[model samples]
Target: MKLDKVNWENYYDKIKGRSPRPLLRAALELEKETSRPNGRFAIDLGCGDGTDTLFLLENGWQVLAIDAEPVALERLLAQVPTDLTKNLQTEVAQFEQLTLPPAQLIHASLSLPFCHPDSFPSLWQKIEASLVENGRFAGNLFGVNDSWAVNAHMNFHTKQSVEALFANFAIDYFDEEDKPGRSTAGSKHWHIFTIIARKMSDSSN
Candidate 1:
């Protein structure tokens, strides 16, 4: 699936009122356990309609929500609470062109797989570089078994490759799911890896 701006805008319209992703919720809960400082920063890449962004803001995290579609950003701004609006910053840009700032948490949710295959490696590098030590990354990555894996425009990874990508991170949550499911767009047979990993603070390299 080539996810152009039009498709993302339509997707935002369809899933506007959806709840935040469970993976994100789990990551937040983990952060709470550490009694971490409030107002930590987060980057929500491809933050369509800002479901996750809104949740982060409500919980006191400053968020930089980036999406390629203007409509997505508009819808997100409309849905966010006025009080939390000050904590939110939005950028209209694609993942391939992303330049992320250092953050305590990086939440991509269901977005990263939409990146073009050729651009995914560079984008992944940026994601890794943008994270602070001990910072967490919470998101889904499409598996090779996904129905959309055949699409050259979409990035899909095998289990081995996914593991290799996070070799420098200490994985806190990793689940591989290959089952029939429907997307917000009404697509079926979803294969995904739900991941929440913290960068290894002790890594020397």
Candidate 2:
């Protein structure tokens, strides 16, 4: 079966009021376990309508919320409270064009798979390099068995590839989901890997 083409603008509208993704929540919880200060920087990749970005700001983090869509940033800024205005910054950029900065946390939810296959490796490398020692990375990756795997523009991975990507990190949370689901794009089967892991401060950890 052919996967329905995504209309991203409408998809953003459909999820406007949704909570932050579980991977992000897990990352936050793990970060708290470190007893670290709350003022660290975080990058919210493909931040869409900025729910995760806002969550970061609310918890005293300085946030850089990046998305390729201007409308998405506009909607996010519109919803931000007046007091939080200072803690948030936004960039309009695609994953392929991403140049991340050193950060304590980097999050992308339901976004990375949309990156073109040709650019995914470099993008992943950038993510790995930009994270500070012990910095956390949280996100979802589409598995090879996903219904959307046939879409040539999107990237999908085998479990081995996903595990390889986090080899240097101590994985904190991982849940593989393969099931039927409905999305704003359409009805489909989902094969997803939800991950939250921290960069190893020393290779030993």
Candidate 3:
């Protein structure tokens, strides 16, 4: 799908009020085990409607929520509780143009797959470089077998490719689903990888 303005707007409208993604929940649990400070920094890429953004804020994390669609931001701001709004900052931008900052967590949800294929590698590099040692990344990536894989505009990876992408990290949770199932947008035949990985400690060579 092209995912133009209309498509994104429709998507936001359809998925409004949804709960945080399971991958994000698992990542948060891993973070809790480390007993970090009360307020950690997170970047929510393609944070449509702020579902996970709200959850992060409620958990005392400062969030920088980025989305390409203005409507998504408007809906997200509207849904956030006023008390937690102070902890949230939003950016209206596309993945190709995003400049990531060092953060404790980077939650992409179903967003990264939407990045343009030609730009995905560079974006992925930025994502990797922006994380502090041990920072976690929780997100979904489309598999080559997915129906949308033929789009050419979007990025899809084989299992090996996906695994290679996490070479510098330790996979805490990796669930691959390849079957005929309806998507959140009511589309069928979904093939996705839900991943939660923590960056490994650096070893000076």
Instruction: State the local distance difference test value for candidate 2.
Output: 0.86
Candidate 1: misplaced stretches above 4 Å?
A: 1-6, 35-39, 202-205
100: Cα error in model 1, Å:
0.7
Whole-model alpha-carbon lDDT for candidate 1: 0.86
lDDT (0 to 1) per candidate: 0.86, 0.86, 0.85
**Candidate 3 per-residue C-alpha lDDT over 111-166 given as tens digits, one digit per residue, 9 for 90 to 100:** 99989999998998888887778888899999988887767778999899999989
- Candidate 3: Cα lDDT at 180: 86
- TM-scores, all candidates, are 0.92, 0.93, 0.92
The better-scoring model by lDDT among 1 and 3 is: 1
RMSD per model, one decimal: 2.1, 2.4, 2.3
lDDT of 2 at 137: 89
**Reference-based TM-score, model 1:** 0.92
Candidate 3: give its CA RMSD in angstroms. Answer: 2.3
Q: What are the per-residue Cα lDDT tens digits for candidate 1 across 1-205? A: 3334446666776875789889899999998874445348999998888888889999989999999888778888988888889899999999989898888899998889989999999999888988888889999999988987767888999999999999999999999999988876566677899999998863522
